[model samples]
Target: MTLKAYRTHFYKELEAFYPQEEYETFFKVLAQEYLKLAAYEIPLNFQLELDEAQRNLFDKALSRLQQNEPLQYIVASTEFYGFPFQLSPAVLIPRPETEELVDWIYTDFKNTSCTILDIGTGSGAIAVSLAKLLPEAKVTAIDVSEDALKIAEANASSNAVNVQFIKQDILDCQALDRSYDVIVSNPPYVRDLEKVEIKANVLNYEPHLALFVEDQNALIFYKKIAELAIQALQPNGILYFEINQYLSVETVGLLKNIGFSQVELRDDFAGKPRMIKAQH
Candidate 1:
């Protein structure tokens, strides 16, 4: 079938399930990946004919999209902080706000040598990016999920950066094995009460273990990490987190109560209070 004909059929089938713009985007992404055609070129290639393999790929992708699987998962990859990362149901897809968190750290420590740890480093997005950006810095990342760690380690290797990956459940640790010049995490901060606000793609496909906390104990990870950071950070070392926007005030207070000094909350580009940094 011709590209234009399939594009029309694709839209017609998914128009009820997704926004017009999004289905168009899905087409564009598939075109790039399966057709090896740029978005600009797609318009010029309406008459292009699809081979059997291309047709089957697009057909299967459309079926998955209808079920609300994330496009990144369908593609099995995503771009984080300008670096490509592999993704799966085992890891939470990296978000733009987390990119901001990485940028904030990079801006502060790009010129210096340091030790860094990324707690719950799903996909190793932050750890790998930092290692690539600050070649002088030593980066280590830990997660409790072995499957997630496998993806994270592959990301580090593919990105050609050296990062140490460890399987660790931070909440059970009595103390960190070694001190770090900087500690960062984008831990489970979504309260159970907030699940109603999550989209189906996220709620259904992403790893909940990396995404949720009980409403009654929403600050569990923050408190535990802060307690460990108190002992694990070098003097004046920094800690950063991609935080739950609604709990910014409580998160800041938690750090201060735990003896972390100079706690600062920062917003993402959308002006949500989505990140925090503190010093020990």
Candidate 2:
């Protein structure tokens, strides 16, 4: 079928499942990946015909999209912090707010050769980006899932950055083996009740272990990580977290109550309380 005709069919198939602008983006991304057609070129070559294999691929992607699969997972890749990362159902797709967390750390410790630990580092987005941005810093990332650790390790290698990948469950650990100058985590802060607010694409396709917590203890990961950071951080070391917006005050209070100083909560680009940094 001609690319233009297929594009129309694609929109019609997915129009109910996704926004017009979003499905439009999906087509552009799939076109580039599957057809080697740039967005600009897609318009100019509307008459171009897709081969059997290409049509098959697009059909499969359409089916997946209709099933609420994320386009990144469909493409098996995403961009984070200006670097390309391979994606899978094993790990959570990196979000832009996490990039803000990385930038905050880089801006603070850009010149220092510090030791950093990233707890619950699903795809190693924060750890790898920090290692790349602050080359002199030593970065270590830990996750409970072997599959996630494998993907995170590959991301570190592919990004050309050195990050130690360790398999550890932060909730089960009592103490860290060593101290770090900076410790950060974008842990599972979404509570069970908040599932209603999540989109079908995320709720259906993303890894649940990396995205949720019990409503009774939504700050479970943050509390444990903060406790570990208190004893595992060097004197005056900083701790960072990507927190849930609805629980910002509670998060900051927990950090302070746990003895963290200079506790500051910051909003993401959308002005939602999504990040926090504290000092030991």
Candidate 3:
């Protein structure tokens, strides 16, 4: 079998689940991952293995993809902010909007010694990125799931950044003693009613606990984190969030209601109101 033949068959198989343009990229990425799994001994020009064992692995992965699982989940890793992070079902994959949030914080505090805290620190993407960018700042990250924290710790190590990973729910975070100069979160904000708008890849592969909120209480985590921020931040501290685009006004309102001044909402690359920042 030649590489061309393998790619042709792969694209045909994926066409049932994806469009041609997406099939092209997905096929290439899957081929790359497969080559890496084989220790790169299999060159890109060669065909993928059709042996029983390798075929089984490919079939399993393709089956999951057909179910609309994210390719990152299938690979169990993703790249964010030029750093590779290990991912699992225990944590939601990091998103580009959250990358903007990190970049915003990094630009504001990269040269400062301000302390930072990241709530709901799934995959430790934000916390680790901050620590890498601002080595002088102390970074602390908190999450409710120990499994997620384990992946986050590994990601912190992989990024060669020191971040304190705490396994405690933000909703139950009461005994914390430290105050941060800047606090950030990309908490669950998807309202139950907005399920139809979500992509099948996200809905199928990503952890729901990290993606959704009650329909009537879509701002649950934001409200809780803002209330906690009142006591967790130093005077005149800043709070940042990757917010749902539909709830930009509500998110800003929540920050104002919490007494955070200088509230600002910014759009992401897609021009959706995706991030909010405010001062306490």
- TM-scores for every candidate against the unseen true structure: 0.98, 0.97, 0.92
- Model 3 stretches astray by more than 4 angstroms: 37-44, 47-52
lDDT at position 247, candidate 1: 97
lDDT on C-alpha atoms for all candidate structures: 0.95, 0.93, 0.85
For each candidate, C-alpha RMSD in Å? 1.0, 1.1, 2.4
Best of the two (1, 2) by lDDT: 1
**lDDT of candidate 3 over 144-214, digit per residue (tens):** 98999999999999888889988888887664578889989999989999999999888877899999999
- Candidate 2 Cα lDDT to native: 0.93
Candidate with better TM-score, 1 vs 3: 1
The best-first sequence of candidates by TM-score reads: 1, 2, 3
Q: Which candidate wins on lDDT?
A: 1
lDDT (Cα, tens digit) per residue for candidate 2, span 1-280: 9999999999999999988999999999999999887778889988998899999999999999999999999999999999889889999999999999999999999988999999998888899999999999999999999999988999999999999999998889988999999999999989999999999989998999999999999999998999989999998899999999999999999999999878989999999999998985
- lDDT (Cα, tens digit) per residue for candidate 1, span 216-280: 99999999999999899998799999999999999999999999879999999999999999995
